[model samples]
Target: MSGEFDRVARLRAIFAGAHRGVILGIGDDAAILAGDVLATGAVLSTDAAIEDVHFRRAWIGQGVTWRDVAYRAAAAALSDLAAMGAEPRAMLTSWAFPRDVGDDVVDEIARGFRDAADVYGAPVIGGNLARAREIGLTTTVIGAAPARAPRRDGAQAGDVLWATGALGEAALGLAALEAGIAREPDAAAFVSRFVRPPSRIDAGRAAAQSAHAMIDVSDGLLQDLGHLCDASGVGARLDALAPTREADALARRLGVDARALLESGGDDYELLITAAPGVDLSRIAHPIGEITREPGIVGATTARTGFDHFG
Candidate 1:
């Protein structure tokens, strides 16, 4: 008798028979699962990181440590939970390492993950290890939210927009690391941003209570905010509150366009939120900009505008 088709068909068969609780099974950037008993409508999301694509060992050179890398990964995954206005509860981490790296490096990396998880009350549950030509980490995080989960599509016309914390420092830090410039103290702050990025879980939870919509600034702020506008069928207008001190100074130092950097730089991980015109934006500490009815447009007061991935 002829066996089944190839491996792909077998895998599809297995997937087709899987449980239906998988609200969003595979085939997207993240997988969303049904919540536990307490959180009947909770959602879980996960993402992975590969060596050359997500990061490079050469970027750290000799100063940064492996532990820092693990912390950064955990923080990044936690940020995804925050973007959805969910409270992170647990995480599963898997790693693949090359034989050349010592066990000590791996231990340090695990320690980093533990420390970061502890900071946010999200414990590491379990993971797997394997040999590979390079290092990789995949973190699966579970989070809890109310019945109606916040989504990228909740934004409305005339909703004011805002961002938490500063911008472009992380990108400038990456630039400095790549250029091997170790003199500026700001560079250290930037590198620290790269090593231990902060997730706006608190802000996300608060925004969910009132804000119309929200998203994390994983890509450039403008690009991600544009995502929210596109998903919600709206546009945006920047008010007086959207400049980063670091962007100006970095512009002077690198002779690069600060406006362009602010628009296109990635990895900030801050929350970009939108709400009605009358909402008290001051309630949230990091107020950045606002939303308007001019569809598909994001207008900034300064020369710096927005980012387009393919542009």
Candidate 2:
């Protein structure tokens, strides 16, 4: 699989088994932490994942558990910290549960949170729980940031645009999950991509050193890049796109255009960056385009639209 990101292996390596800054965690009115841990600066971010909106119970362990759901929620939030080139210090989660849900279900969700936090060496500090008609989770992450963390508005007109991982794989995974069609190896791979997406924390950190601007590709490459361009007062030219063969085949099986999925499918959690020509992000990311002085994305073979929460 060309352009494949070895996320699972990388995450396992990142799980070095120690929490960073915590005087207290998970068992108090509020978490206590070592403020001096983030002596440089603090980067904070939050994300929400609601059932039937962000996920469906049937899609995850046949409605029997929600471990993946909670883990994904944490990853989504942590991805924001990654965009800012931050190293996680602590995390908090607030869960909304159905009144009749059992203790075992809650335990599974907690386990999920623990596992996700472990990947980043961030401990679960604190959170609130509430009863609701549907299950949902909101995760907040705090991390230590560089003196000048990367910003979305710092891109220059001639900067080269790069991406940290494969696009469209997660989207393909999503389609496979929805269609319940994981008979092929590619399909199963895609399903895993959707089930356990990775946050490019290390890549973001490396890129931050040289990247003029950065953003996570959570809302699809085109849309998220548009956001970067808008913030940086520039545009972009997507000279080339390379969707993995697995993604291409899966898209064909699902009767959708692979290129469109590569361009606009969301939930990838990869980083999009803008850097000067000589800067080397090759070990972590690859060039995809160039920043333009114009006001919109150009050069894509197809007209595309990204995920719209309201649309």
Candidate 3:
């Protein structure tokens, strides 16, 4: 496959058959009601975290614990609800643990998920447990949708693009962990963000007031922006873009480009919004750009696709 998006598109093209019960399928942050639990018109999404893929087990002794890993996985899944302008309701999380691990470790993992889920008042509902070679987590988040779901396909030209919080916060933490800096005292902030990724539920609910479209930046700012543009059949301009302060400082310390991190690094998990003209958008996030008639990013350095498991 050329990339993750290309692979997904190929699969969808081959399986063009439709399911009458699906309100939205395979293309959004979460699928709307019709085929999933909470089928009373609520939005639902599933996300996965696999050992040695999304994270490594070696980090356990190096400042990253199994509890943190479980929490991150749950937070990542819940972020999908935030993207759809939906209110958190409940989650079903499936976990696979090897036989060698102690039962106490499993309890700790469940507690971790519980801690994070408690933040949005989304309790763990039900899930499966199985034997496996390594630990893996898959969480499905269900939420009540607003009257008109904020879709990625609804953005139009001339609409303004806004983003919740700064970009690359979580990526900076990932970089620290990769560079063996997680042990450093100054790395706490970045490491915390990486381990305890935030779900922008409130921000998304606020944006729903005027947002024409919305998405969560789990895949990276530029990459997810491209997804939004492609869905809306439009383009965007980054002329008004400004790098996150943390991104700039971290990039300088690491001898990398802040803009590059902001553009292509994944796992930020912030909201990306597109609003119509004359509508007062939420002040919770910063304005990044405006929609355009053409495709691709403009007004800065070129950016490639963000992380893809199979790319």
Best by lDDT: 2
Residues 208-288, candidate 3: write the lDDT tens digits.
777899999988888899899999999999864556666677767777676777787788888999998677665677677
Residue range 1-311, candidate 2, lDDT tens digits: 11113422332233323455687665446877787988888899989999898888777563223777777888888999899988888888887877666665666677777788888767777777677899889988999997668899999999999988788788888887788775456687777677678868888887878889999988888899989999999999997786777677778889888888789888999999999988888999888999999889998876658878899
TM-score of each: 0.81, 0.91, 0.84
lDDT at position 80, candidate 1: 83
Error of 3 at 41 (Å): 2.0
Number of the predicted model whose TM-score against the real structure is largest: 2
Q: Each candidate's root-mean-square deviation in Å?
A: 8.7, 7.5, 10.3
Q: How badly does each model clash, as a count of residue pairs?
A: 2, 1, 0
lDDT scores in order? 0.69, 0.80, 0.77
Model 3 TM-score, all chains together:
0.84
Better of 2 and 3 by TM-score: 2
Better of 1 and 3 by TM-score: 3
Clashes of 1: 2
Please identify which of the two predictions, 1 or 2, would achieve the higher lDDT against the true structure: 2
Regions of model 3 farther than 4 Å from truth: 1-40, 244-246
